[model samples]
Target: MKKLIETIVKPLVDHPDDVRIGVEERQGRLVCSLSVHPEDMGKVIGKQGRVASAIRTVVNSAEGAGRKRVRVDIMD
Candidate 1:
């Protein structure tokens, strides 16, 4: 799960090395915290948050079997 987020976000960022993801299990839900370079924050989030939404959708679809709720937080 972490790798999937990394793979999708890393390439789009100007600083791939700065892309970091942290996963935490809270109340049976998975929360993914994505940290990217300041310069690439807008890119990962996209206009009106479309990119963030897409990433969450992919995570949700991929975790269908487990029915785990996934949330993505784009952090500066």
Candidate 2:
């Protein structure tokens, strides 16, 4: 799960090394808190949050991600 997210966002950031993802279980769901360099936030989030939405959709639909609900949150 972590690797999937890293693969998705690394190339979109100017500071790939600064990208971090924290995984936690919350209310029976898998929560992924994603943090990226400030400058790359916009790129990861994209216009009107479209990119972020897309990412979350993928996470939710990913096979082998388990049956638990998966959430992707962009953290500042």
Off by over 4 Å in 1: none
Q: What is the lDDT of residue 30 in candidate 2?
A: 89
Model 2: per-residue Cα lDDT over 1-76, one tens digit each: 7888999999988999999999999999889999999999999999999999988888788834558998898998
Candidate no. 1 TM-score: 0.93
**Candidate 2: where is the Cα deviation over 4 Å?**
63-66
Question: Per-residue lDDT for 36 in model 1?
Answer: 90
**What CA RMSD would candidate 1 show?**
1.0
lDDT of each: 0.90, 0.91
- TM-score for each candidate, following the candidate numbering: 0.93, 0.93
Summing lDDT over every window of 10 consecutive residues in candidate 1, give the lowest-scoring window: 59-68
Residue 12 CA displacement from its true place in model 2, Å = 0.6
Q: What is the lDDT of residue 62 in candidate 1?
A: 85
